[model samples]
Target: MKKMKALIVAAAALSLSALLLAGCGGAPANDKKAEDKAPAKEEKTTLVVGLDNAYPPYGFIGDDGNLTGFDIDLATEVAERNGWDLELEAIDWDAKDALLNQGTINCIWNGFTMEGREGKYAFSKPYMHNEQVVVVKADSGIDSLEGLAGKNVMTQVDSAALDVLEDEEGQKALADTFAGGAAQTIGDYNNAFMQLESGTVDAVACDLSIADYQMAAKPDMFVKLEPLSTENYAVGFAKDGDQAMVDAVNKTLKEMYDDGTIAELCEKWGEYGITIDNWVLVD
Candidate 1:
């Protein structure tokens, strides 16, 4: 009987050891399986671009009621190159600064002018050229800057034209001739042209590209006056934005330019007078 009890005790001890070993050995495998089933870390890959969609050949609502333009196409390419998704935010032109400052938009990719706005925001390399010009009714009898004297003149709010009228020294003399005592600021070019067509305003000071588009779309209604001031277009970021982001955009733009993508897009928008022949990536 003593031998039998001792053998049974020994067998129990071995079984206990096996159970402990098995418990220890199985822990790591179970933990690895659990870890493998865990969800992956999600990364952000969406870029929100801000623009005055009312501005055509850059960004505008198409006849199909969809957003389409030169800037939109360029931005789509940039997003694709980075494996990111593009979200177009058609914003009020006058509120662009507010949008950027509040983090509502990632960047302004419209035909945004960079001259005279130094230190206001981080800028990408100038990618295109633009000129400010005045548009008047074909028979309004205003053919020159001098003809604008004592006439009701208007420009879109927060536009390069308004900036020139408000700040540039050489243009101040001409800006002072508006019939309203100062150049009136409209919400958008559409409104400015409406006021012009209705004879409420004598002329609309706007970008040369936009003027050309407007005139082409309504040939007999308006004609472009001589350019008021030449400027360059660049992407605008917040003043405190990440420089790395701007650098990334500049790099991509240069790549596009070198690969002839920029030229191709210019050709696509050539009817609107958009050109990139003078564009050399500003270092």
Candidate 2:
């Protein structure tokens, strides 16, 4: 009976050893299965671009009432390359600063000029250079910025034109000569041009790019006087002093310039010969 008990104990020990070996051999398989069934993860990327819905060629509402324009296309291309979802926001021109400051949007991607707005926001490297021109009827006999002197001139409120007219040493001298006869303030270039159309204003002082777009839109009715002032356009962000976004955009733009992408876009948009002078981080 003692011999039989010892044999049973040895059999039990052998069975336990076999069970331990099997468990150790299958451990890697369990781990591999868990790894294979792990949940898939999506990368986070979203760019919200803000713009005025009334500024055409740069940004405006299409016949479909959706925002579409050159700036919109440019921002969309950037987002696509960076694997980000693009959210084009139609915002009021007056609300741009507040919107950016409050983080309601990531950037003001409109045709935001760098003339008077410099130092007020974090700006991307200049992407395009443009001039301000006077728009008058074909028969208005206006041929120069000075021709608007003593005549009704129209520009948008808060526009570079207004600032230029107010500059102590700049074009303000020209407007100062006119003083009470200086350009009237309007809502936008559209309104300025409309005032010219209705003969309520003799001339309009605004950016050359918008004038070019207007010529493209209504070639027969309007003509440009001459380029008065020009400036580079930039992307504006909150004044957080962080330039990572501006730097990235500048780098991308440089790549675009090197690859002829900028040239192509300009030609496609009919803004050829308009190029950025320099791209550098200010802060």
- State each model's CA lDDT, in order: 0.87, 0.76
Note the residue pairs that clash in candidate 1: none
Can you give the TM-score per candidate against the true fold?
0.84, 0.77
Using TM-score as the measure, which candidate wins?
1
- Per residue, candidate 2 scores C-alpha lDDT tens digits across 155-230 of 8877777777778766777776563746688887887788788998887877777787777777888899766676
Q: Which residue pairs overlap in candidate 2's backbone?
A: none
- How much is the lDDT of residue 262 in candidate 1? 87
Q: Each model's RMSD to truth, in Å?
A: 6.3, 8.1
Off by over 4 Å in 1: 1-42
Number of clashing pairs per prediction, in order: 0, 0
